[model samples]
Structures are given as C-alpha cells and as structure tokens.
Target: MKVLISGASVAGPVLAHWLHRYGFEPTIVERTPELRHGLGGHAVDLFSSAAEVTRWMGCWDAIDAARTRIDSMTMERFGRRPVEVDLSRMYAGISSSHVEILRGELTRILYDASRDTAEYIFGDSIASLSDDGSGVDVTFDSGTQRRFDLVIGADGLHSNVRRLAFGPEEPLRRWLGGYLAVFSMPDIFDVGNHTLAHLSVDKLVGIYGVHQTGQTRSGFLFRTPHELRYDYRDKDEQKALLVKEFSNYGWRVPQLLEHLESAEDFYFDSIAQITLDTWSKGRIGLVGDAGYCPGPAVGGGTSLAVMTAYVLARELAAARSDLASGLKSYERIIRPLVDQSRRIGPKLMGTIIPGSPLALRLMPFAAATLAKLPTAMQRFIWSQNAVGKTLSSVNLVQPQVSQSVA
Candidate 1:
C-alpha cells in the first residue's frame, strides 16, 4: 500500500519508518524548505513508551547521546533565595526510561532513520485532500497532484492536513488560558548544563543552557484572563506583545529582552489543546498533535506524539488491505491515552505557573522537597499522579507481520 504523511518533524517521520517496515510505501510532505536538523528548537521529553519506540527503531542510542544534559534547576523568586531542584532525579522518578533532547535534533534523527525507506518532499504541502473511500487524491501547494492508498497528518498543532481534512482549528481548539514564547540567545549568565527560572504569580521566565551550541534559550510562560488577538505568523507582533506583558516585570528580564529583536528563531504560541471527536474521515486520518494536542509545554506532547504514531502504523499494518478498519482501530486504541493526556496540561499549568502568591511560594518548596526524596519514595509518589499513571499504562508489543503483506 502507498501512504502519504504530512509534516516531517516528529510524528510524520516515525509513521513513515514503521509503514515502510510493515511493507508499505510512505511519502512525506513537509512545508519547510529543508530539514530542520540542528541544535535549535525547544527541549522536549521522551518517556518510557516513546523511548521504547525509538529503541525498537534502533535510534535509542543516538537520541540518548544527543540528550540535553541538564540535570538541575534553580528556581528564583524576587527577594528570596534560589531553590535548587534535581531535574535528573525528578525525571527518573517519573519514568524508568526518559530523555530530554532538542526537538530539532530528534527530528533529524527520526528523519535520517526513515529517509532511506520513504520518499520525502520538502518545501511543499497538501493544498487539498479528496478522500474517495478507495484512495486519497492529494493536491500540493506546489501544484503537484498524487493519489495514495491513505493519507495521515502527523503534523503538529496548527496542522495543514488537519485544516484540510477536518475543518477550521478554532472550534476544535480549547485555549488553556496560557501562552508560551521561546528564543535563543548567547549564554550571558554562563549557565552550563543547568536551568535557571524566575517564578512569579501567573508568570514564569526560564533560561536553560544548550551544551551542543554553547548558547542558551529563554522561555517565558504566562497566564492570561482572556485569549489575546494577534497573527500567528507575525514574529514582530508577538515580540512586542511579550515585551508589553513583561515590561514591568523584573529579574534579568531586561537583559533577555535586549536580544529579542535579533533572535531569528523566536517562537510564540498559545497553550491550547485540540478536541476532535475522531481522527479520521474515510481514507484521511490524523496522528500526533494534529489530531489531539493535550497542550504545549505543560503537557507530555512529545511522548504522546511518538507513541500514537507507532500505534497508528501497527494498527494499519494489522488491518492490511482494509485500511478504513485500521484507522478506526487506531482511534479506538489511542482514545484512552489521549483523554488521559488532556487532563495533564491544566493541572500542570496550575502547579507550574502559580495563580497566587501562596502557590508561588509553595511550588518551589514542593519541587525541592520532591527532588530531595529517596528514588523509591519519589517513584511511589509520582506513580499516583496523572503523568505516572499515563506512562505506566502504555503497553505496546510488536506483533509479527502476517504473511499476507509479503
């Protein structure tokens, strides 16, 4: 069978890899002109199940070696002493196998693994998708037309495939009452393999080192009473908005803002989740953040994306010629995980970005205390939370390919 996948970042490449392995031809269409493979981009985590998928792909060792070796974090409040938390220890408590790596690096690794097996088309996108029950006829923005047995959207939030296959994103999107901005800058504080964060009520400013580039990334996450209106594509407008919001805010923010205008890779977006009743319509289906994004930053989106793509591929292969049944089975299998994942973002937002002064004080204290706990006790405590429960519940075993495929 021939399949076409959208967005080459995380899920697309992963789905491509597995589809090819399962006796299917996969073609990837990425909007970007070239592969984004470098030290740039925000840090993302891969928990046990996601790690296991990579291990099965034979990419685990490479990903582990490329991990961001940030082991500790220092939380600061205005006029208060810094509270230190062992991030490595905390991560260990959360999942037995976990790695934090730059999103670009992970994409590069996944892309490299799948590039040899799949056909990749960069600098183009699906302009329209016509699923005729038998196949999906896709028209690209570059004016190329092709037909595939199935089409999948592995794109991230604000996916082009989702917009084309489903409807507009506004009705399906649930704003989580927060926003996030990230940009790269010189390592002025000389922070090496550590994260420094300044927390205030309803707001957080963080700077973490990128050992591979010898630079640092500044991230600002803040809560708003109502959604802000702005063009998602305008970087200048977003930068100005960020400055206005944090104008009166103190604590090294001024220094950070100085480099904002010149930062070419600045990213700004709302922390929102996609609520779709189903991920498929006939031969067209959606995977990863395209279909169901719990929320960005706060939610374990990376792991969710990785695991769902893997499941989608497995289900499709199992269904063989009946691809429609495969899509339905994929949705049914992942619905529980997706539902459980949606609950994580809001609870984490309340905890990470405090709503009150009391919470601001208590958040750091709680993190420090958790980090100080013994590994066993920490695991016990974490196992009771939403994240732990979600991670532990994911069970994926490789099923033998039926002789029918060959």
Candidate 2:
C-alpha cells in the first residue's frame, strides 16, 4: 500500500515511521524548504502515554537529553515583590512520566530517526487530492502528480490538507479570545537559568533561559475579544501588531519588543481549537492538530499529537485491508482525550491570564503557597486542575508485532 503524508513536523514524520513499520510505503511532502531546526519553537511537554510511545520508538533517551531542565519559575508584578515557585515540586503532582523538550529539538530527533526509512520531499505540498473510490490522486505545488492508496493530513492548525479535504476552516475553528507569539532572543534580561514571567490583567509576558542552547525563549499571550487583522505569512505585519498591543505595558516589554523586530523565527497565531464531526471522508484522514486541536499553549496539544499518531498506526495495523474500520477505530480510541483537552483549556483561562488587578496580585501568592505546601496536599490541590488528570488518563495499548520493518 502507498500512503502520502503532509506536513513533516511532529505528526507527519511519526505517522511515516509507523506506516513503514506496518508494511506500507509512505512518502512525506513538507512545505518548509528543509527540516526545521534551532530555536524556532517554545517549550513543549509529553505526558504519560506520549512519553511511553517515544520509549517504544527508542528515541526517549535522545529526547530527554535535550530537555529544557528548568528548575524554577519566578513571577513578578509591577509594584509587588516577585515570588519564586519550584517547578520540580509542581510537576510532581502530575505524573512522573513526562518529557519537557523544545519543540524544534524533538522534531529534529524524530526526523533523524525516520529519515532513512521513508521518502521525504521538502519544499513541496499537496496542491490537490482527488479520491475516486479506489485511491487518492495528489497534485503537488511543484507541479508533480501521483496516486496513493491513502493520504493523511498531519498538517498543523491551519492545515492546507484540511482545507482541501474537509472544506473551509472558518466554521470548524473555535477562537479562544487570545493570541500567542513566541520568538528567540538573547538573555538581555540577564536571567541566568530560571524562568521569569510578568503578568498584568488580561496579558502575560515570559522569558526563560534554554539550558545549553545559549539563547532564551520569550512569549507574549494576551486576551483579545475579537480576532485581529493581519496575514498569517506576513512577519513584519505580525511584529507590528504585537508591538502595537504590548508597547505600553511595563517590565521588560521594551527589550522584548526590540528583540522581536529582528528575531528570525517569530511565530504568531490565534489561540483556537479545531473540532470536526468526523476525521475522515473516503481515502483521506486527518491526525493531530488537523482533526482536533485543543487550543495552543493551554492544552497538552503536543502530547496529543504524539499519542494519536501511535494509536492511529496501531489501529491501521490491526485492521489490515480495511482502511475505513481502522480510521473509525482510531477516532474512537482518541476522541475522549481530545474532548477532555478542549474542556481543560477554558478552565485554565482564569489561572493563565488574570482578569483583574486583584487576580494578578493574588496569582503569585497562590502559586507560592501551593509550591511550599506538603507533597500530599499539593497533590490534592492539583487534582482540581483538569489538565493534569486528563494527561494521566491517556493510555495507548501496544499491538503485537512479530516482524520488523526491513
């Protein structure tokens, strides 16, 4: 069987790895000119089953070596004393089985692991896909054409494949009334190794030193009742918009803006989730953020991407010669976790972005108090947070495989 996968970031490469393992010939078409690397992305976490899947792929050790290793995080208000929270203690309430790494680093590791196993075509994308009851005829942006038995849309939030296969994305997109921008900057704030964050009503700015990378990761997330005007591909316009939104704010805003002007890897997007009634129609299917993205920065979307790829591959292996059944079973096994992730994002808004002056004043105190509490009490307190519980509940069953991919 021949499979064509789109967007070679996290999910696309992972799906390629498993498709090859299941005796299927897989080819990946990535829009980016090359494998994306360096400080292009922010810190992301893999929880429970996601981490286990990496171990099963034999890349956990490489992933762990590239972790952010952030030991503490300090919160500061405009006129108040900064309160430091121990990050290690905070993560304990969550499962011990977690891997926190830079998104780019993880992507590079996955690419290296699977580069030789699959045929990868960079600087291209699927321009059109036609399914005629037997296979998908794919047309590439570079003007090449091919036919495959199946096509998977592992592309991200604004997936081109989703637009072509499903329809327009406006109705399926649910905006969460916020925007997030991340970029790489020098440690101009002089933060040695700890993460420093400043919060105001309806806005938050943070900077954290990435351990061995010699660079810092900074982000700006703010609430906006309505979507702003800008093109997703225009970097200068996006930077100008960010400056316009955060120029009057206090505490390192000026310096952060100064770096933003020249940062090569600036990423800006609305905080939105994608919900669909079904992930597949005919020979086309969607995975990860393409099908059910649970907002960015708030939910564990990375973990969902990793685990869903594994689950989808397993179901396909189980339902050999029955692609529709495999897609249905894949959706069945993954929906509960996707639903829980979406629900948890809204619940965290109050904690993530303070709504009032009083909320900002109390935020550091609450975090400090919780960080200093007894282990058992901390666990009980975190039990109230829906994100942690939902992350722990993801359990993917491994299928029995007698033969390995040659």
Candidate 3:
C-alpha cells in the first residue's frame, strides 16, 4: 500500500517510520523548504508513554542530548516581587519519566529518524485531493499529480489538507479565548539557565535562554473573547497586530517587540483547539493537530501527536486491507485520551494567566504551594489531573505485520 502524508514535522515522520516498518510505502510532502533546526520554539513535554514511543523509534538518546536544561522558573507580577519555582521538582510531581525538549529539536530528531525510510518532498504542498473509492488522487502545488491508497494530514492547526479534505476549519476549531506569539532573540537579559515569566490579568510574557544554544526564546500570550480578523499567512500584519496589542505592556516586552521586527522565525497564532467528528473520511485521514489538537503550545500536544501516529500505524498494520476498520480502530483507541488532553488548557487558563487581579495574585501562591508539596503527594495530585490520566492511558502494543504489503 502507498500512503501520502502532509506536513513532515512531528506526526508525519512518525507515521512514515511505522508504516515503513509495517511493510508499506509512505511519502511525505512538507510545505517548508527543509527541516527546522536550531530555530527556537517553545519547549514541549513528553509523558512516560510518549517518551517511550521516541525510544521505540530510536530517537530518545538524540532527544535527550538536545533537551532544554532550565533549572527553575521565575514568575513576576509587575508591582510585586518575583517568585521562583523549581522546575525539576515540579516536573517530578507529574511523572518521573517526563522529558522536556525544544520543539525544533524534536522535529529534527523525528525527521532524521524517518528520512532514510520515507521519501520527503519539501518546498511544495497538496494543491488538491480527490478520493474516488479506490484511492486518493493528489495534486501538488508544483503541478505534479499522483495517486496513493491513503492520504494523511499531520499538518499543524491550519492544515491545508484538512481544509481540502474536511472543508473549512472554523467549525471544527474552538478558540480558547487567547493568542500566543513566540520569537527568538539574543539573550540580552542574560537570564542564563533560568526561565522567566511575567504575568498579569489576561497576559503572560515568558523568556528562557539555553546556555548551549546561546539564544533565547520569548513568548507572549493574552486573552481575547472574540477572534481577530487578519490573514493567517501575512507575517507583517501578524507582527503589526502583536505590536498594537502589546506595545504598552511592562517587563522586557518593549525589547521583545523590538527584536520581533527582525526575528526570522516569528510565529503568531490563536490558542485554539481542533475537535473533529471523525478523523477519517473514505481514503483520507487526519493525524495530530490536523485532527484533534487540544491546544497549541500547552498541554500534551507533542505527546498526543506521537501517540496518535503510533496508534494509527499499528491499527493500519493490523487491519491490512481494510482502511475503514483500521481508521475506526485508530480513532476508538485514541479519542478518549484526546478528550482528556483537550481539557488541560481550558482548566489551567485561569491558573496560568488569571482573568482577574485576585486570580493573578494567587497564581504564584498556587505554584509555591505545589512546589512545596511532597514528591509523592504531588505525584498523586497530578495523577488525578486530566493531563495525567491522558498521559497514563496511552499503552500501544507493537503491531505485528500480518503480511508484507511492501
């Protein structure tokens, strides 16, 4: 069987890897010119099962070597003193096996692991897709046309393939009443090995510098009840909107905005979640953010991406000639976890960036209290949380190939 996948970031590569291992041919088309490396993005966490999946794919050692090494997090409220929270101890409460790595590093690792086995077509995108019972006929932006047994969209939130396969995103999207912007800049503040965050009612500005990389990543997030009107593809307009929203903010926001002018990899997006009725339609399917994204840059999105791809490939291998059965099984096994993970962002929104002064004042107090809890008690508390249940629930049995489809 031949499978064509869109977006080569996290889920696409993992799907390609497992499909190849299970005796299927997979090709990936990525819109970006090449794999992103060293270009800064926020850090992502992989729970126990997701981290195990990386080791299963043979990328854990490389990922571990490239992991971000922040020792602590400092939270500051403009008029108040800063409160320091120990990250190492806090993470222990969630899971003893949680792994933290930058988004770019994880993408690079996944790409490297799959490049040898999968054919990657960069610098182009799927222009159109038509599934006529037997297979999906794909047309690329470069005017190339091809047919594959199945098509998967592992693209991020604004998935081109999803738009083509499932119609518009607005209906499937649930905006979390917030927007997030992230960009890299020089470590001017010299916040060496420490993560710094300034919070206010409805606003948060965070900066963290990696000593090994000699670069800092700054992120801004603020809440808005209604959607802002703008072209998603317009970089200049996006930056301008960010400037307009954050121009008068305190902390190092002024400098952060100044650096945004020249930042090569500036990214801005609404903190939204994608919930679909079904992840597959006929021979076409959606994976990762394209299908069931809880919330971008928060919760277990990266972990969910890895887990979903693994489940999808395993189900496909098990149900060899039956695409419908395979897709149904894949969705059935993964949907519960997706539902639980989707709750993390909305539940923590007020805690992360309060909507009122009282909540803002209590944010640090909450963190300090959490940090002070005994490791075992913290672990128990976290295990009871939605994110914890979602993380602990993923247990993928390695798929055994019934026959060679290669």
TM-score of every prediction relative to native: 0.98, 0.96, 0.97
Where does candidate 3 clash, by residue pair? none
Backbone clash tally (model 1): 0
lDDT of 1 by residue, 23-72 (tens): 99999999989998787788999998999999999999999999999999
- Give the alpha carbon lDDT tens digit for every residue of 201-278 in model 3: 999999998666688889888887678988888999999999989999967898888899899888898888998989
CA lDDT for candidate 1: 0.92
Summing lDDT over every window of 10 consecutive residues in candidate 2, give the lowest-scoring window. 397-406
Clashing pairs in 1: none
List the pairs of residues colliding in candidate 2: none
Order of quality (lDDT): 1, 3, 2
lDDT of 2 by residue, 1-406 (tens): 7888898888888888888777878898999899897546988888778888888787899998888888799898888888899877777656567767889999998888778888999999889999997889999999999999889999999999999999999999988888899999888877767899999899999999877767888989899877887888898998889999998997888988888878888999888899898998888999999998888898788888999998887787777777777889998988888888888777666678897888898888888777778777877766676776677666666656533332
Which segments of model 3 are wrong by more than 4 Å?
398-403
Best by TM-score: 1
| C-alpha lDDT score of every prediction, in listed order | 0.92, 0.85, 0.87
**For each candidate, how many residue pairs have backbone atoms clashing (under 3 Å)?**
0, 0, 0
For residue 335, what is the lDDT in candidate 3? 84
